[model samples]
Target: MTTPAPQPIDRSGFGTTGKFNVSLSKRYNFDKIFSTAAWVATLFGLVVLAVLLVDILIDGLGRIDWAFLTSFSSRRAAAAGILAPLVGSIWLLVVTALVSFPLGVGAGIYLEEYAKDNWFTRLIEINIANLAAVPSIIYGLLGLQIFVRWLQPITNGRSVLAGALTLSLLILPIIIITTREALRAVPDSLRQAGFALGATRWQVIREHIFPIALPGILTGTILALSRAIGETAPLIVIGAVSYIAFLPELSPKGLQSSFTALPIQIFDWVSRPQTQFHTNAAAGIIILMVVLLIMNASAIYLRNKFQRNRP
Candidate 1:
């Protein structure tokens, strides 16, 4: 029998380069083609994001001055300020966090840890998924009917409490989903260790699992609130005024008074005839973007901290 020639070593670590390596195949060019395609797609997405950021900065930068940040809304574009809208948005974020976080996190723990993986839990899970996809406008309608009107006896109509509750409901599903994912990421070995050490179920979740998952829960909460902050329809349906001059205070009476958010204020300005008002609206957009970026960054920092601390 004739002896075959030995193949030279392939530097890229594909063993037996003459036969077993897929990248050396003549018929299939998958690796090169797929890698190139993936890189192109990633570059395209980055380019799009860069273009959007550039456009917004170019249009809005000059319009954002001290006066714009500090003044109240008025008929004249120069006189209008974002103070009240900024304060209102801040209040909304605070109240929404306070109201939503505990309820959402608790429900998530119950579902993920306490409940059995039976038909009822599955049904609840499916409904939550469906709720997440429902149009935000539908949540707006629910806020209008249930929070703004039906719960008038409790909240007395169109209050910040109502708005917060509406936003809470909208974001609750997101929180639950994210929290569950975080909980699931906790290694089963950790739970087993805790139990083997004579820990109860509650103790395992409280001491061993929750600390590991807290960062993810916080990330989800920030993301959900970001969504709520950008929303206009729900606030509009619940009767957010477009021309409020004063900042929102936390008291019940304060909440009953008229208010505005950044988006609504921007909308009101952009709808006007003056060119300067449009510029003001663009400035408002920039402000909203900055706030969102800050919130997201803080959440990311929290996530990193937790990940670092996790054992």
Candidate 2:
């Protein structure tokens, strides 16, 4: 078994050095080129987005005012306002959050923490991932059949309640996925420590894991809601009217009232031939953008806050 040890390769042989044979200058040049290209692409995207925001501001700045915020849609473009859709959107958001949060977060915790790793769980995970990518219009049609037709008595036939349920279904996958990811982000040692202290699984999750992951969960929720708020096609399919003359009453009955949303109202205005309507549409678009941006900003702030506060 005693044999001669292998000899070291000759470093001075340039031809035998595969990758090492390449000139350092050539590698450096390639890296520089790729880096420059990346920067250019990034800047180009930023420039386009900035141009869009600036244009929207120019077109919509004058149209937004106290009256625009407080009044209702009218036949006259100048008199039309977003109050109905605004209030409806608020109602829809509240109801959607109420319905989706507990269900989604609970499912996530069950799947990630409690559920056994079996074929059934894997199948559910696969389905949940796929469902998150399903076209929203399909969910809308499903909602129309289930919420609008089947549950007409409860939803009052294409009311805010039905629309909220539809959107709740739409965003449930996102929330669940986000929540699981947030839970997964927590260290397993935290769970072990709780177990060492004689705490139950649920208690560990509720007291330790949830508190650590709260910011991420909340951020995901806000982003999901932002997406729901801006959705028009699903709302259209579920009969969210483009024009509603009156606001929903501030009662449980209001959940069953006919409604519209900001996106639907904007879509309606953009469709009209009148220039004033187009201008008003721009204004509505701005308000919707502001809402979405605010939500996104809040998510960023929460995420940063949690990272800063983490021990």
Candidate 3:
């Protein structure tokens, strides 16, 4: 004999038997409140960012000109330019990249691909995270002590090399952290496949793992460099001069000469009572922003290209 079919419940408050019957309108309204809150918060942050950029553009655009970009600093408003600081900033970037990239990548590889989940590795991991969180100014102080004083013979006291070394320390932890995350993101199956094909551990990391992780590493390095470029306090603490008048050349004498970066130049200009200097400061800011944007864009392009070239 066939069993009788169960009757379907009706919802005119008739056959519904649950203690709580959720009406669609009530549920929709409840969800709407949360969705609105999330969107509002995101939009608020975006609006603030937009306002800041607009304000900067409005204030700084008038200061940019061909002469302003290429001339050296002077006491007179008509003669002062950003040449020295621009050169100094370029030197800082090149040196920092040279010193930081290999060390950071190596550390990342050690941590991600090789380190076991032992107490020592755990401790190292914890310290690296903590170091990343430490205030940048503290790195400045450490740099002042280590690079400026103890290593003065090598860097010649607050020179471009000293500044680069200091900045490297400041960004090293960040680079390593980003690289480790990138390395970790590669699928385990890829590694397993490499091993299954009789590839050595080193070969697997060198050929397969690095190519996949390269994009992420490059992204992180760019971000780290961006942070380094904008840094003023550490450079100040390391005694980067603000009144440099000549472009930094690649010689020992040039290295020993006083230097200034874009931020330092801007700070110097803004601190002056003259309105023209303030305008110059604004110009320097715009230049700095442009350079940073270009660097970030290049990084993104490299990342995309690498991804497309991946096999």
Top candidate by lDDT: 2
Q: Summarize candidate 1's per-residue lDDT along 1-311 as a digit string, tens digits.
A: 99999868767776666655665574357777888999999999999999988887888799888998999989888788999999888878888899889998999999999999899999999999899888777898999899888889877788777887888888989999999998998889989999999999999998989999999899999999999999988888888888877777677576565567898898898889998888888889999999999999999999999889975
> If the candidates were sorted by their lDDT against the true structure, best first, what order would they fall in?
2, 3, 1
Instruction: List the candidate 3 regions with Cα displacement exceeding 4 Å.
Output: 1-31
Ranking by TM-score: 2, 3, 1
Candidate 1 shows a clash count of: 1
Q: Which ten residues in a row have the lowest lDDT in candidate 1?
A: 19-28
Better of 1 and 3 by TM-score: 3
User: Total clashing residue pairs per candidate?
Assistant: 1, 0, 0
When 1 and 2 are scored with lDDT, the better candidate is 2
CA lDDT, every model vs. true structure: 0.87, 0.92, 0.89
Query: Which digits, one per residue and each the tens of the lDDT, describe model 3 over residues 79-175?
Result: 7888889999998998899999999999999989988899999999999999998898999999999999999888889999889989999999999
Mind giving the per-residue lDDT tens digits that candidate 2 earns over 21-136? 56656889999999999999999999999998888888888999999999999889999999998888889989999999999999999999999999999999999999999999
Candidate with the larger lDDT of 2 and 3: 2
What clash pairs does model 1 have?
A: 71-81
Q: Judging by TM-score, tell me the better candidate of 2 and 3.
A: 2
